[model samples]
Target: MAVPPALETPESDGDATSGGPEDLQRQSWTRRTFGAVIENPHFRNLFIGNIFQFGSMQMQLVVRSWLVFHITGSFAALGTVALANAIPGLLLSPVGGLIADRAPKKTIIQSAQIYNMANAAVLAALAAGWLGVELAFWHLFLSSFLQGGVNSIMMPSRQSMISDLVPRDRLMNVIGINSSGQTFMQLVGPGIAGFLIAALSPAAVFGVMAALYFFAVTFTMRLPTKPLYAFAQSDAGRAAKQARSGGRRSNGFKDLKDGMRYVATDPTIRMLIMVNFLIVVVAMPYTMLLAGFVKDILHKGAFEQGILQSVQGLGAVGGSIFIASSASKGRGKMMIGWGALLGVGIVAFSISTSFWITLPIMIFIGAAQAGRMAIGQVLVQSYSEEEYRGRVQSVWFMQFSLVQFGTFLVSILAEFAGPQVAIGGLAALLVLAMGLIALFVPAMRRLD
Candidate 1:
């Protein structure tokens, strides 16, 4: 089968637009790297909105995990909170993607944002004790479950819209730059959240999150309303569209089934998803468990924990920039290399007791995570047909549920084996898994 030109490098927009050497020189370094996508009015709005969206989320992670551990001092409880968040995504993400394919994605995204803002407001009230109800573990758990459901529904449309706004060839740069924005929030959101939690209360953090969520909704509302679906561009995309032409407006379940079949039958997509899933399950749980790890191992509190996350985000920002500027060849190999480095960093982090030493290791882990995340999404979207793109992304998101399950199990292991062994063992497994994939998955290695 002949690969489409979309899979290779396409003509640079710069080549056509640059008037002369003077014009090229006038473009700032930042403009040269990201101006292509950010300059789009629609992309600019979405990008700015995502900064607020991601900021709230990063802050919530720190606040929530710290609250859980502070309340129960049990690793199992932290895992349970993660599980609460994951279960809804496990069940509703596919349906969310189906809706994205059939509805105006902007509407779907804005609705979810509004829902999150309200949810955050309620949590803020509850935490403030204005209701005269003492906060309990179940309150946090229930809040997490509801918030997770909304996120599962929201993420597919948000991710799929990136391709809609940009040219196909710019997908890598756009996704990389988007990830950079996310990492930028990761750098500061948690540190600020930690400070607020220490200085005021958890209620303060929730209030800030609500404000950020409101801004996210405002920016999303500015995006031009698009049609329910775009025209299919790839040969496979056209074939998939035609196959379901008679029932193009069929019920959601049927559309979902068709999407699942498409994914199951495509070898390249299956491999890409498998590699990503395994890496996520084995290597990603450390973040979920880090709160406990910090207190127990590093003898730290909320403030130090947040600082570590900020350092990790610092490395991640750098990694995403490198990807944004990089050549679009051998991305598959590069992703695997990053995953391996992440595993190694996690292993080093697991054994380290000094906070200073762990800071640098966290930076290493963050860089690796940024590369793996940006490259994986780019590959999956690059290879999938347009009609199935949302479904593909939802499936990609299903890994979150699996990783939460992995966190739950590791938490149990930590209960018996200690955090060091529980986390280190999984990191080792990730390193081994990446090596095997590189050696055996020839098609994946040859993706570009």
Candidate 2:
């Protein structure tokens, strides 16, 4: 019920009354752009660490999807790998959120990175034939499954830690900057991974990915072990300490139930979750099916797919920065507009047969996605109470699992009706869905 320590100091106005035009402009620009990184040492570390974290993830996405498609030559198998990754997140992410609320976030983050590094190392060994085993499809699937579980457990802490590190007024700015950092990695990591896969081997790409994860771990190690608000005179703080003292089992389920009830009762959180979930399930499946689509429809190979992803990242970087610099008003409308644009871009992409044409469309899709994510996340973090933030993010993250399930269904459709038809139809559906939501959800449109 009390104000958080992080929110105690409001964002600086930076001499709006006396400063000259250039001074005011510079102050406004810095506040919107890099204020979080410049002001908070912890957040700066997290920002740099995320560069490595996202690099490994972006590369893994390209490599793993390509590996499955390359080995099995089946759209169904690609969807299966996605599904394998989604299942653990769906089942356990709430528990992960609970752990995040109670545990030392730095420890949780470091442990997860170590696990990911090990997973990548094993995959690299198998791919290189150094493990005396051929890299089988099951091995990839198993690694995906395990990694998904770890991510579900780790992501809540990582996301909620942002609020711990900065003031409430700067939440949107920092979140956008974070998105841009990840997008920047996307811009280069995939292309590099693709080139490595082409020049050397998949094993070498995996090896590079493992090293990136290690760097991420080292950076995360510099964050404070305890949260900024850990000693605040609040029930959540006490609960955190008690939970850490090995009392979690007795009240874990109760905490989970309480978190769910909190989300269920809050209309803004509920609407945001619904809209995000719909977009993920209806509009995002194209990504899972992208490799097969490129191969079958665009007549491209792994390098081409990676290039497309990199191009998308370029769009994402521009989009995230734009949102970060924009006024934090009408964010709900911004989210809706971006979501609709994403559908429109996907439709364009699905209809295009030429790789060159799809290149520009991928950029459009990437920007739309970045906008949708940044705005939607800002709204969620802004509206949720500090104590319930981690649990809220965990529930929000369930969309990942649902999107994978959507990918599986879309993959089956692609197998039967061809990638073009399946993808195009889904894009049309997303457009229609967003339009209806905009028409009916007036309250959501009014949210800032």
Reference-based lDDT, residue 143, model 2: 94
What candidate 2 gets wrong by more than 4 Å, as runs, is: 1-31, 66-76, 129-134, 229-250, 299-303, 414-421
- Taken over the whole model, the C-alpha lDDT of each candidate is 0.82, 0.83
Score candidate 2 by lDDT.
0.83
Q: Supply every candidate's count of residue pairs whose N, Cα or C atoms clash at under 3 angstroms.
A: 0, 0
Which 10 successive residues of model 2 have the least lDDT summed? 1-10
Q: Please give the range of 10 consecutive residues that has the lowest summed lDDT in model 1.
A: 1-10
